[model samples]
Target: MHSRHMSIVIPDTTADAVYAFAADPDNLPQWAAGLASGVRRVGDTLVVDSPMGEVTVRFEPTNRYGILDHDVTLPDGTVVANPLRVLAHPEGAEVIFTVRQRDMTDEQFEADCAAVERDLAALAAAVTV
Candidate 1:
């Protein structure tokens, strides 16, 4: 029910390259520090070792466009849909993430937004490096 969005721009990179990297769930840990660790594939599932515990991440099927939407299933079985996208920009590329402010306190929501910013920064650094 909570709807918010955060984004970052990656310089000197094409949307194609950015999507190529960001679209892969296995590359999440390198950028998403909140996950606490990298993801590994178990059959068709991508599992992440998060601070809250193991979480399952399911990404949309691959496409030429820069859509990187995914679903995160928490340990408690709550599924959070994360709408993410990469778009071509004259400056290079832009990565956007939607932050849903579910039942959390205002402070918690702020922290979540901050975490998304951090993750986007990490992603920019990883791709630009």
Candidate 2:
């Protein structure tokens, strides 16, 4: 199990307003830059579509937080589980995306962190400006 933490600050933005986008799966590509789409329900799993490949993603939201679980299958038939959390921050929001990979290395985890960071920035920009 590998864990990484990421945060994005949205100036003059409320948590709920930001969450409306974060909570919606259809809006993922808007921020993630990957043309990703998902269902917003607990059991509704979203799939990110790309020419390289496709990934099945799911998100679970609580009264105070949200969790996104993604399973990406490589063209070679290898699959990975990436679970992320979105929590309320004092000033903005926090997203903790975790990955449990048996065949990957720490460097891969770092790359995943970078991906999440991009998403965070997108999330902030979507609501602030």
Candidate 3:
């Protein structure tokens, strides 16, 4: 599988603030528009209504390390791992998202990457506001 790292620096924002917002599944729909439409707690998992279908998202336990890694289970029972991080930057905080090309064509991968870019931009806007 091939992977691409997409990132954006939110000027004047703290890593803690960025992490706090990004770590919450409920806030995903606000920034990650391409990934989630709505989210609700379902026992131990976060049930998400996505464009693909209803999926389950499992995030790593909250920590001070700025790790927002998560596993997304598709409706077909396929699990896709997403690695995300918020790091302290000179200006503010940098958010990085890893997009993987598991079994997609080059065009599909490019589209996926573009979507991630847009999402990261949205994240920066939301966190900085």
lDDT tens digits, residue span 1-129, model 2: 655556666655666677666766667767875445442333565556654466555455444555555565555556666675656677766556554446558887677677778877787777666
* Candidate 1 worst ten-residue window by lDDT: 35-44
Clashing pairs for predicted structure model 3, backbone only: none
TM-scores for all predictions: 0.94, 0.68, 0.96
The TM-score of predicted model 2 comes to 0.68
Residue 87 in model 3: lDDT:
98
lDDT of each: 0.88, 0.62, 0.90
Model 2: which ten-residue window has the lowest total lDDT?
A: 33-42
- Residue pairs with backbone overlap in model 1: 2-101
Candidate 3, residue 54: how far the Cα is off, in Å: 0.3
Order of models, best lDDT first? 3, 1, 2
The true-versus-predicted C-alpha distance at residue 15 of model 1, in Å, is: 0.7
> Best to worst by TM-score, what's the order?
3, 1, 2
- lDDT tens per residue, model 3, 1-129: 899999999999899999999987778988997566768888768988888999998999999999999999999999999999999999999999999999999999999999999999999988877
Could you give me the TM-score of model 3 versus the true structure? 0.96
Candidate 2: RMSD over Cα atoms? 3.8
Model 1, span 15-54: residue lDDT tens: 9999999877767778988675857897767889998899
Model 3 global lDDT (CA atoms, 0 to 1): 0.90
Give the number of the best model, judged by TM-score: 3
Any runs in candidate 1 off by more than 4 Å, and if so which? none
**What lDDT does model 2 reach?**
0.62
